[model samples]
Target: MTALMTAELAWYATGRFYRANDGSLADYGYFLHLPFADAPLFDGKPSETSAHFTFAATPFKADGIDNGALSLGLDPVGQFSLYLQRRPGATFADPASFAQGECIATFRRTSLVVGTTVAASLTSASGAILGTNVFSARLIASNPFEFAGKLYDLAQTVGMGITQFGTAATTPVAPPPPGYDLVLPFTGSAIALGRAG
Candidate 1:
């Protein structure tokens, strides 16, 4: 009878922010994640598929305020994925396919703004001639904020494209059936803003 076993893996990241201009004000803060997983074969083996996380300070920029006071914010975004492919044998210098890895998840953020202004003036000459003038102005701003994060696990599976096995045996193959369970987690954050001066 074939034997079966299970494994687990995990990862995490963190960061801090200080005011680049003024020590009293916090300019930005952030955190990011690298890929990780849990499985028997995954021990020390290089990961085929991996993920990254990112985070940053909010309210990147602001303008058009009577007072110079500025407000800040934060946001996060990232991606995650898993790997499926066979591990190269000890003697196999270049195995057809190492670990087939891919990203299956993603995230993002968005924001926008618009504005307008108008003015008019008139003047009279000594004779009877009159002169008039009118002026108008419009301003628009569109700023987008984005953040993302991701987590992933590694596994053994078949190759793709030219590396695909013959039709009869083309089906993807997962070594150790149950495979390894890895948890590589990551996080990211950021903020952006636009305004008319």
Candidate 2:
């Protein structure tokens, strides 16, 4: 048998939970609404509508912990897709045209990304590491499209970092590892479509 030395990253061992304003756990990973651009049609202009996009979060396993806190990384290894469910006269033949009857536009694009984050703990005065922070970088490419009879490419970069805050009081817990700390709260932004080679 082969000897194996496996070290599990903090982000994998410890799960991150998110709650909405009403305190319900937020299920979806990423959420956004993107509007379509106007295009020239046979008679009238192409219909303009918005597509709802959603992405689920998945963990990127790391090698090991350095310094004191745990480090987690994110790359665009996950899948990305889009949905357009409401359009006028939309159909497969004339998907985005006003004369068509198709109401949905679906596409899956190829993407990749790379980034790192530190897990820390939250304190009344100072902060610590609780091994629940997540950081990541992502590069996404839109499905190739032909505009004006020419092929064009579109891509995007997304950087994200997140941590939790607070803990259940009353349940006295043991101190974490020597350098480990508590969790902090964070908000992040996303990138849609960008130019790519």
Candidate 3:
């Protein structure tokens, strides 16, 4: 998908659960919003505002983990990086889940590298550093397709890592968070769209 290098790709990821480093579990839910960019009227045709795709979270899924956005970048020479953000929402259905907070994940391909992908930090809305995570991602597919003049890929991915209750940045509190030291195994699929026409 070299075409993705010059364009911004919009993607969505979802998994069944968030397993902590210590072997606990929390519910996982996801949402997908389509129409990455504005499609304007052309050739005297009407704008298609009603054509869209959305996936609402199921009742069994935790609330705060509802919406997620993903950005994947792959360079010409075969390097890749990804950024994922999940917005916080209502109370958690699974008490094992982390406290309501805005979570961000940043990871890079490590196949040719020496170490694990960079660690990601989770922070509360209050700006307090919650915890940190270290994980590695594997791209399951690279086949690309075109839709409405845009390039698209239905990519599958898998990850394994640990989420510890404290950050390596500074002194962690006396007692770690609820899901501290939990093992995390992830399986996700994303609908990626390239912006370049």
Candidate 4:
């Protein structure tokens, strides 16, 4: 039997902001330093076959910051959605780099604003077995709140990305719009489960 490998989820998020004053776009972005996972995603034999993964998270305090301060200046899930992406040949080794492969799952909401406790979980199957030895995932949040120089009704939807486990380097889906200061990153680690082999 192949040796079992432990995996932790890592990522970085970028938020597109807007101003309620002149309908201008602003807010750069921030990184979230996540805590270690409570347990390994999988503890079974390694294989390049189909599998299901569930990713979940909550918005809360972190780094002396109370809750996620991305848009509304507070920690709120802001969006109630989850997503996954796994192409054939994906693996658990060095799973931070989400380049390209079979898309097992993906969920990005245009309008999702909810607390951590009510947040939804994402899942998907690679189908017939596919993926590398490492586990990798990508969470996309596309919600910008702030209209006419005022904080829009649910204008705090963005997370950080993780490239290396210990490295400080991370990436975002898009850069912060001009004149916008990306809000703070959210605390609380997301959940990743190896649903099946």
Best by TM-score: 2
Judged by lDDT against the true structure, how good is candidate 1?
0.19
Residue 18, candidate 3: alpha-carbon lDDT: 36
lDDT of 2 by residue, 5-123 (tens): 12211011111122222322211111222222232221234322222222223322223333454343223334323222223233212122222232122222233332223442122
- After superposing candidate 3 on the true structure, give the runs of residues whose Cα lies further than 4 Å from its correct spot: 6-27, 31-128, 134-136, 142-151, 155-197
Candidate 4 Cα outliers beyond 4 Å, as residue runs? 1-113, 116-177
**Which regions of candidate 2 deviate over 4 angstroms?**
1-28, 32-51, 57-60, 70-78, 83-187, 191-193
Name the weakest run of 10 consecutive residues (lDDT summed) in model 4: 117-126
Worst 10 residues of 3 by lDDT: 70-79
lDDT of 4 by residue, 1-197 (tens): 11112233433332222221233222222123222123222224423222212222222221111233211122222222322223323232212212232222233322222222111110111121211111123334323322224331111211332122111111222233343222211223333322234
Q: Can you give the TM-score per candidate against the true fold?
A: 0.18, 0.28, 0.24, 0.20
- In order, candidate lDDTs are 0.19, 0.25, 0.27, 0.24
Model 2 TM-score, all chains together: 0.28
Q: How far is candidate 4 from the true structure (C-alpha RMSD, Å)?
A: 19.0
Query: Which number leads on lDDT?
Result: 3
Question: For model 1, where is the 10-residue window of minimal lDDT?
Answer: 158-167
lDDT of 3 at 3: 28
Better of 2 and 3 by lDDT: 3
